[model samples]
Target: METRLSLRYTGPAVDEGLMDVYQASANMIAFSEFMVTAVKATFGDAADAKANVAGFGKGSFITDLVFSVGGPAATIFASFTSDHLVTVLQEAFGLWKHLKGSPPTEVNQSGQSVSVTNNTGQIIQVQTDTLNLVFSEKGADSVGRFIKDALNQTGITGVEIASKGEPVAHVAQHEADYFVPVAKESPVSENVVTMALILVAPVFQDGNKWRFSDGTGTSSFSAAIEDQTFIARVNNGERFGKGDVLTVEMRIVQTRTSNKISVERVVLRVLEHREAAQQPSLV
Candidate 1:
């Protein structure tokens, strides 16, 4: 499905309807990344999508891009027409603009309505659907920063993005920085659990996360080694090769800001290590 969107960059530099290829390419990459990231955030990770430039020209240096979805995303939108897709992106940009960069201080969902509290404790109410974009994986803030930062570069005085039949959402050059994602981190929850994890890939370097598979060996994840004794033993010549299963006590931390969700795990104790059966070498 193709949903058309337009982006117009206006400034003295674009007055001649010409832009340096290098700058144009940078802007294009940033914008395209935003589209891909936004789709995944709003529509869930199953979305395999792309925003292709349909047309571009001088005259304020505008470009028309077509959003197309495939794979699981198509199934998710089986009932949604092309018009619905356009509305989807429109809402994404709207919420991105509404947040202006900072993540909500608190969010409460009740039925189809939501209460969002900003940094200053100002409570604003919005529909649940309007927030699927901002309240998704990392929210729209992370994607907004990079795209807006790209526009802030060069001689871009302002930018406007819109889909058909929608009012233009404007971003002044000065306001580009206004979309910077919050750098602060807030802890959500933490817990310790003992499990046997098969090492997928172990980082040999200090202060790095080691990869492992879940106890059921069905999923994989990465965690840091906070067990000093285990690290010391490894440093002293302990072998923890790929496919070795380690029964460990791991502390899992869940953190988030308005931008995204983060989960960090630390191996607090290493209880057992079972090596994968090694083939005998014929001498």
Candidate 2:
């Protein structure tokens, strides 16, 4: 009952004016009376329809945008069909194609499915009987807000993410599409860039390079360190391995080859290590 959209932007540079225009369009959809009325009519009184003037389906909208100069800036937006809210948002974005010359590179839709791991190595048959929705990375305007608003609108008793012992809020970046120019000058040089990210997957050595998961669910990078001392520490002893939750600072070298800025590899450096504090388990 959910629609996921992956919008790709390919151009030289995305001017601030383009972002402003897209933001204005998004706001129009957010405040559109026709869309709100349609949602309220579809869901009816017993279920959807919040006390807020916007009403029904307003809580289902979630967007994430990642834009880098000289690269494809993509935005992912997810919505639900229980109240026809997702459709309305999609239509709103579609209007851009008619108004502007180009449209989004891709649009995708997927259903909700639960994946369970059998760590015990025992055969188990699971049947579908109950349904539940869990929200993570709580924020005022993120997925957490949508769930909260949906509960209030539907009068559904649900536990807030904070109540489940998670951080109530975190920094959030608003995501939307932008028009990038095709022939702009390079903004940055080939320098080592640093980033701090959470290690989601187990750090495993893949040949000479080590694969890493930054938990972004989209892009993953590989690490190659010239320093053999650190490699010996990890390979010989259990200094830092899988299941050890810690914040890592990584050094990345971005080299522009031809027209694209290519990130050759990332060097894993442990700026801070807290082995005892395992990764937070969201209930």
Candidate 3:
């Protein structure tokens, strides 16, 4: 069955300086994408390159490169299905953790504050030591893994069916409307299941206009709205506009023969007003 997984980048709108910082953060995200490609490349099956591939791959062979320019890091999505969904997702989590930081710190003790560094080196101290480590193998499994495993646990046995498809590609330009499947019905045949992942990014424009789309359609917000110093939502959609803030939210969903699981990673970016001074604003 087909399994889909998606990653999204959301944050405040962009100004020239803020764009520079987002570009730096994009490097780390690009590294994570590279790790995903490298892991999938090792699998046999020429079709494997096409099937379990990353968004940046092109040409005949799947390349372990991400080509999209950094612009308010966007979301990412991927999906696949096999009896070994657990094993595959486990490997993915291993690679993701190796590339990203360890799942948010887990506080054995409560009320104790800990220092966590953002993409920027600035260290921020939180009041609680109980960092919600969402993607823990023992705790809450990776969303992708959770979905895949959930389907597998149904106990309805089936044969292993494989298919050859093109390697997934990432969209270069931003879109306002897109569809990402969050869940799916049971598999038709035994041991077979299908799933999909959706990556979404919010875009805002000048005059307080904003929209949310993913290489598909566009949806507008009400008016230019500001929560704190950042623009929250313009019309009604999630995309950010020029002079508005942008936020990227990454979520992974997995579907198994019987169950499903999901996990999310959220990052924020504040687009500085081009006319504003260079001082950093509070988040």
Candidate with maximal lDDT: 1
Task: Rank all candidate structures by their lDDT, best first, as comma-separated numbers.
Answer: 1, 2, 3
lDDT (tens digit, per residue) of candidate 1 on 213-236: 885747788888888998888898
Q: Estimate each model's TM-score.
A: 0.55, 0.27, 0.18
Q: Put down candidate 2 lDDT per residue, 1-283, tens digits, no spaces.
A: 2212221121222222232344333433432332333333233222223212222122122222111112121111122233234333333222221222122222222343222222233222211110010100111123223322222322232311111122222111222211111111233444454554444444446456655556568775566655455556667765655434444445555643224565665555555444535668899
As a TM-score, model 1 comes out at 0.55
Query: In angstroms, what RMSD does candidate 3 have relative to the true structure?
Result: 23.2
| Span of 10 residues, lowest total lDDT, candidate 3 | 171-180
Candidate 2, superposed: residue stretches over 4 Å from native: 1-188, 200-207, 215-217, 239-249, 276-283
lDDT scores of the candidates, listed in order:
0.67, 0.32, 0.29
Model 3, CA-based lDDT: 0.29
Give per-model CA RMSD. Answer: 7.8, 21.7, 23.2
Residue 263 lDDT in model 1? 90
**Candidate 1 or 3, higher TM-score?**
1
Model 3, span 1-283: residue lDDT tens: 2333333222232211232344333433432343334324222112122233345211112212222212232122122223233234334333233324322222233354444443334444432211222222222333322222222322311111111342222221121111112122233322211211122223355444233223234442222223434544334554433333333332222334213443222222334322212468898
Q: Global CA lDDT of candidate 1, please? A: 0.67
Backbone clash numbers for all candidates listed: 2, 4, 65
